[model samples]
Target: MSDKSIRVAVNGYGVIGKRVADAVTRQDDMQLAGIADTSVDWRLRVANQRGYRVFAATPKAHTSMSKAGIVLSGNLDDLLDEADIVVDCTPKHVATGNVALFRKRGLRFIVQGGEPHALTEHSFVAESNFDSAVGRYETRIVSCNTTSIVRTLGALKRAGLLKKARGTLLRRATDPWESHQSGIMNTLVPEQSIPSHQGPDAQSVDPDFDVVTMAVKVPETLAHLHYWNVELSRAADREEVLAAFHSSTRIAMVRLDDGLTGINSVKELMADLKRPNDNLYEVALWEDLVTIQNNELFYAYMVDNQAIVIPETIDAIRALTGLSTDSQKSIAKTNAALGIGSALY
Candidate 1:
């Protein structure tokens, strides 16, 4: 790796953007160039307190932000000029327009999964496609749900034990901060479809991988739970499947005895451990949930939606800057730097 640090910028300073900026700051080969956001809120204020160069995402927001006592470094163009690569963490559907801007400036960028599937050259999961992302101008990190799905399936596939997989995703209705948003309380809204878009989103990352998924939005902000039933080419016992997950670096096995018997318990564990943002980066799987019958494996795992993609975003920086070509090495570095896999739960 070169001695020079990669200058990285974040376009949005919302939920994911703040985490990405923090993750970038922790990396040895990357620096947080600045963050751009349209609004002047607690998120931007926190970015300022953390000593990040804050930029205005839109021209009109500048005057308002200045009025709100928040100092602005420059506009979006200036931020693009200063950054080696930008991670677009804008909310879902907001990044479509920014793609053309990045292309116009000839700047390499990483976008979140909320963007369209075709927005980038490829859908990136560091463990599955890190090498493919190197030297590419645009890389899209799959959504939190998609990340959980792909990691689970990818591990089984790598073991040559996966045939077909079907899952039900119990999604959180809103983020912890989005209490004012509709559907944040007292609801379990199902996505009235046989197979939700998340399965197809996962397939976009690996066309050969087969999975069918259904989703229901629950009124909790902790995590998204996935219940999967996978068919293997050959018969495998529960121990064998659990062993496969244990061998994988990105997957974390949770035992009942560990005091993480439920999703809320996992969150409490993060709080007790004093994890930043109470983040659990690894895919958390229940030890007792793994079962096998007639070559079919059934298991349940939880994905910390807000934290799952932070490491992937960090890996994207490595890929875009040609800093690291090996996914294992990149993952190890990120996990160690951010305390990802060290949590008790």
Candidate 2:
């Protein structure tokens, strides 16, 4: 192990876990420790193909792995005892139990978006609160929506332009596996009992951040879109917000000029890039238009805010854990390195 490297074990080897594992392996200061999951199909096969040590909770998964000529020990504790940090990507219901077990064994834990909506004690974004993550035993990354909204709000708050914020989320439904496994697919539900799970957690960082969310599920399995309403403390011109989005290194604000009417849907936009959350490109903010009833209040176009904010969640994990690096500079550098374009004021 490199002296500066931190060992990280990804607990659930699903879609998110696989992504997390891939990211961890690429970091110079981090090492791919291991992966744990009971699932015995392609996810496990992918992990094995990448040369990560795999731990199986169920005998069936292990037996399947053995049949495939993989040579990993089936002990879960072995992974827990060896790694310095663990990322829990299990579903919300199962996350706490698995995370608590790792904590009991004296391991630092990072909870994925499955984090409880009210858990404000954890830093919401890794990049935004990285310093807070250092030397901490545990931290939670707010859900993707929370992550995206926080970054946008964070910039506004810093600029002293934001007074209140509201959000409308239009979601999509792809397939049963994607929905049951990912949840909130093929369904548009107004804010019900669940509360904007990430919204409250976000406001804990900034009390002025007020958010309202409405979700709609479409037929395609593309990205989520947002329509935002903002009540600014000061009557700011639209150009200011537009400029901020243009200058944000971590955000991608696309200006849908009148001549640019062709890109109306998220599917077309996704096809244009041919990648999911391309370099924190999930978020796109359009120029805000003043309302006729109240010119001071304005509306803006927004895209998947979750993609831009996921790194902040990662940055928070590093900071709260006393991991090396400054949060803000780290995020800015990462964005630049990734060639992500954002407008920051």
TM-score of each: 0.96, 0.81
Stretches of candidate 1 exceeding 4 Å from the true structure: 1-3, 342-345
> Candidate 1, residues 1-345: lDDT per residue as tens digits?
235989998998888998998888888888888999988778778778878999988889888898887888999999999889999999898888899999998999988998887878599998788888988899899999999888889989888899999999999888878857755566678999979989999998888788999999888877899999998979887777877787667788887787778899988877887889898888989877788889889999889999999999998889878888888899899988988763354
TM-score, prediction 2: 0.81
Off by over 4 Å in 2: 58-60, 67-73, 117-120, 174-188, 193-195, 257-282, 287-310, 336-339, 343-345
Q: Candidate 2, residues 1-345: lDDT per residue as tens digits?
A: 468777888888765666677666655666878998877577677677768899875567677667766667666777877787788877665786775577678887877666663443665554345665667777777666666677677666666777777766665454224755655534455655444555676765555676655555554444556666777767666666655545445555554552323224443555455444332344555543423234344444444432444455445546655565676666664454344555421
For candidate 2, the per-residue lDDT at 187 reads 48
TM-score of 1: 0.96
| Pairs with steric clashes in candidate 1 | none
Estimate the lDDT of model 1.
0.87
Q: Give lDDT per model, in order.
A: 0.87, 0.61
Best by TM-score: 1
Judging by lDDT against the true structure, name the best candidate: 1
Backbone collision count in every prediction?
0, 32
